[model samples]
Target: MIACPRTLFWIVLLVAACFLAGTTSGAASVPAPADGPGLTVVMDNNYPPFSFRDANGELVGISVDLWRLWEQQTGENVQITGLEWDDAIRRMEAGEFDVIDTVFYSEERGEIYDFTAPYTDVDAVIFFDADLPGISGLDSLDGFVVGANRGDSTVKELQEKGITVRKYPSYEAVVSAAKAGEIVVFILDKPGGVYYLHREGIQDRFHYSAPVIRGQLHRAVKKGDAALVTKIDEGFASIPKAAYDDLDRKWYGTPVAEPADLRLITFFAIVAVLIILLLVVLNHTLKQSVAMKTEELKQELDHRRRADEALNRATQKLGFLNAITFNDLQNAVFSLSGFLELEKSLPADEKTLAYRQKQAEILHQITAMLRFAKNYEDLGMKPPVWQNVSQTFLIAISHLDMAGLRRTITLDNLEIYADPLLERVFLTLAKNVLLHGKTATEISLSCKRTQEGLVLVFEDNGAGIPLAMKEKIFERRFEGKKGLGLFLAREILSITGITLTESGTEGQGARFVMLVPEGAYRFTDNS
Candidate 1:
């Protein structure tokens, strides 16, 4: 009996060793010659429309279609692996995958990966709470805590400006934080944010700011994958616009019809048929009716063209005016900076110098507001560049002369992509604190990222905005005869696709919060 058991164990060990050898041989054999250059592409299976898993657990979307075309054209044997976005990115960075599909190229990304020519364009926007004031541009987010996705381009941009940025790992975390009042603002790519908001049934709870930051979506390849990138570029160039349009219609449910050919042959065919009928009286009547109809159509078209031109001119004029005003404000601030420097050199009369320095600081705040306004005007222009939130904040704070404010501003490493107009929103709120919260000695500003978007918080221990004024604050020309700073702040923020609102009450001081919608930030060649 002992001998029989020992023999059985040896037999089982022999089978296991054979199986291991076969597995090793399979892995070492390499892909067949006909399989072409074996390459593995990584992508996020959770991102819909671009790349995602279907109901049957199949990886599919526009990126998949494009990848198939690439394989066909280049004879590259490609395998796809679906993973989480962060995991895919990390793996690609680690050189574990040959490529990552559907990423937006930015300055920060340029350091990490080689990007192909863009295949799609998108925007980053700001989304605010339902009770928030309407935001028309970037200027409306002043003093609001903004939330953004961690490791996103928008976080860098927000940090560039003086605005506070909070970072979160995922979109869901951002939404939860916003709902919990942990952050006031969120920013994200437009479609992704909208999809998430709708999916979470929070569409009615938040609003997006306008004048979106445009970003171009592209495929990312491992650095030094020049051959692959060139092949992709060539393939993209070869694909007909019609084919792309058709694919778009298929996925997005939008019909795209080709224009009918209007060749001479077609016109002559109709003419010949009419003449062959030989109905002279009918032809004359028809010609008269057609002429009248054409004339009317031409008249309407001319009127519409004129109207469009007039509207464009008016918009241009308004933009120019805003720019000029912004410049004036900047000049005033610059002058104040110089005066403050001069005051340092003058004989020190402690109290008088202090008062003068305070005055200069106040002027500095006004300049910040002006800079924000200028940014708003610039963002309104066609082909606006991505505004760096971090840079803007640095500029705003650099002018503040911290020695004078008696308040500390704490900011986390958060970035956001928004139009420069958002700076004005921050400036406006800060200016309000200086003007109205005179008794308040301490003000706090913070920013962090949330999964849903970016959230910003601004709080001051001063006389807060009255309840009566809260509703009216965002209205244009409100705030009792003052320049439409708050109103324009709201309007400017709206233009960037974000919303701003007041939270907390008078006795509790004031808290301003802003949310950036998903898809609000994007990468674009036009910058």
Candidate 2:
């Protein structure tokens, strides 16, 4: 159905050339003709191998041969004329020709042309690009733009089924319209469509489905031309059944085999197989390499295991030795303090009293230093655990005897993973504020979450630390009321990677802000 003009033109030339071989029956067997009526019969040229032209511009096909036989049997000069399907129909409607030898039967056209008794059957089918999946039949044509030859049986058939079709003037026009995106599929008689595709050298470009509409193909004459219709029926009846069989065998005996390029398929198949073999070899090599590396890694881990045990044993011994030695030194200091106390009570002048006082002061400072060392030694000795911040703050404050200090605790369900000495960190902060904030009152504890971490603010409204001394406040043995509380608090927090900084209004209150890193903190849903 998609045959180009040149294709049919060439076919017409070939058929005409067949006539030039001296006579139409020059090569083939046929009964000699006895001329009768010289009537002209017009038909659609688009119906290839049925009623189409050849390379010599001569008519040749199923109906053409039948008409030739009809002329031989009936002794009539049955001249055949070929026109585009649509033009043929228009001319026939205008009575430009006396009769149409090959036309499909439909009720709408019955009003315009009288038809003979039905002959052989023809199928209506769907054709589309071969790359697409085959659609089973008409029921599957929803949403498709179907092309149909104008005035062809396929157009009215598709329309009756409520399917949309773009009518083209000719087969070539339909193909062009489809290629131009006007339609997605085309509808036509299956064999003629396939033969057209073959002639055009585009058989592999398309595929067609089984019959969608099966109808009895009939030849029609002018409306009320009962005489012409009767004559066609007589011609068909006169033809022998064996002659019809012979014609069928001659036209459609051989099946058209699909011309495929097998060499390309074989080349790609070999490449695929080689790539698979290479992957197999590489996989085996990689497995062997991994096994060797794994053995080496096992040996390295064995050496590290022995080294770690030795280091742990040595650390344990050092800790035990330090504990024993510090205990003995503390006893000796206690004994010296007692002896100095007894001697100071016995007797002395002003200079002697001052000398005794100096000795007592030095002993007290030494005791403080020894106690700090003992507490510091255990700071990071224990693994960190999740401790409730509110409970820890309460415990730290309880030990401080904050009866004279008014402070509010706003800690909710917050908890953090930190050393057991975390309690001491808070205790140290409370003790520092009591000793340092001279006019301080109303200390408050609250928290806020930030991009970098969590912040716990311990602040008080007081004549806070001076600007120059803010950073210096946390320095070891700097001029606080006495011991290194702030410095030791920072050291305790650092064991678990928490950081502490002072960021209050210096004149209003001294604020200690502790930033707990991201992974180290989470909130309880109940809070």
Candidate 3:
């Protein structure tokens, strides 16, 4: 009976050894499976190429492949589960899973999980509107709201760096928000972001920075799980180099190596030869078509250039003629004003005096109109430029007689993209305060950063504009009542998507706020 029991034990051991050898012939370093329950491996369900559902809804990716290889090598039964990244982490921390992959190593994470050697590196990046200039890295995100995926390691990383990030549910959601114009700046993993950007076909609308943070992805267990850690490490270490490389090639787009077949090579060579022969036959036709298209395009461009030149010449001639006419009109108005003044000195009846006063008022109106025309003629003649706010304000004040009034500017080292007439905007504003701001003692200019963009505030402590005239003050028809400078200022700002609005208490002051849209203003180092 004793011999029989011993023989049965030997038979059982032989069968188990045979099974292990068959499963992992070259992987001797892999430890034998523990006798208890199998491991539960969990990973992100939507992270493509690293573990995501295929079109058929089957879970797949490099992480999935590596785990399966580990299972085979170690002779362990691993039940793999796919969940959203946050849920996966939450469940694993809840003790629902024994292992998790596709996780980045951070100090906070290291405190909760025991990480294995890194399997891959993922770069985190910042993507902003292509038109938003001067944003080179994280330091450039000051005063701007940034968006990111909820529960991502990147969010924590950014928070640690003191960057304020708006969280979305996923990278796809971030891209959708950007497309909807809800967000201008966002963060995401480079590969995933590129995938969604290309899929949405809005890749050209955004610019991304170089890797802001490179997270080494690893498979980890709850902290203090040394047994499981050892198994995972050894299991992966035992995988053949070629097998590991194959996984990378299959999922990460590295080209696969294959044995060359002479038959296949010969067949491709013949096809290439046939293609070349056909190309040679069609080369003359293609060259003729291309040459004709090129010549046609060249002729069209030449015609467009000549037409542009002709239009410019016509514009110049009209301006010259208008200038001459304006000069003649000014001289005539000047002579009329002199005659009216001379008439004023001569004694006249009441009715004649009223007629002479009316004539003088009409002449003054004509002179104001002529001055407006001269200033308005140059509007939009030159392209918009970036002007320093403080410097431009000084220039505008230089052109005005700002005596008896204290001028205050708190604009910092800010700059704006506006038409060259930007100077006219400040000049016109200052002139309005001097002319209309009765009881006004001080004029102040400042800026406030907001979600929509920058608000340039121009305020004055004066009798303030009557509530009724706020909107009408910018109307073209109001030009005769309140001069045309305000109307002209509105037009100049609108050319660059900036808006002007009056928002102040009637008794407090006249507050004109110019809304400078994002991408139209930036702060310098002095700010």
- Give a tens-digit lDDT track for model 1, residues 332-422: 6677776677687778778657759677666766755655455445434442234545445534443232223444445543444444556
Question: What ranking emerges by lDDT with the best candidate at the front?
Answer: 3, 2, 1
**Model 1 regions more than 4 Å off:** 1-37, 53-58, 134-139, 176-182, 240-243, 255-527
Q: Model 2, range 1-527, lDDT digits (tens) per residue?
A: 11112322333333333233235333543543555557778888767556766656666666777777777677777767889887888888887887786677777888888988876666778887553453678877665567888878778767877887778777656655544434447887765666555545666667788888787667788888899889878986788777777655444442232224345666789999999999998979877888889989985675455345434543564475478557856765776676677666777777667657766765665666567666667765555667778767755664443534566666667887676788898888887777777788667889999998999888887767777777777775623334467777877676556888888876798889999987666666653
Candidate 1 lDDT (Cα, 0 to 1): 0.62
Quick one: best lDDT, which candidate?
Answer: 3
- Candidate 2: where are CA atoms >4 Å away? 1-26, 29-37, 160-162, 176-182, 254-527
lDDT of 3 by residue, 102-218 (tens): 888888898999998887767788887764655678887765567888779878767877876778876678888777655668888776676667667788878889888877778
Model 2 quality (TM-score):
0.42
Model 1, 340: alpha-carbon shift in Å?
Answer: 34
| Stretch of 10 with least lDDT, candidate 1 | 1-10
Instruction: List the global CA lDDT of all models.
Output: 0.62, 0.69, 0.73
Model 3 clash pairs are none
Q: Model 3 scores what on Cα lDDT? A: 0.73
What is the clash tally of candidate 3?
A: 0
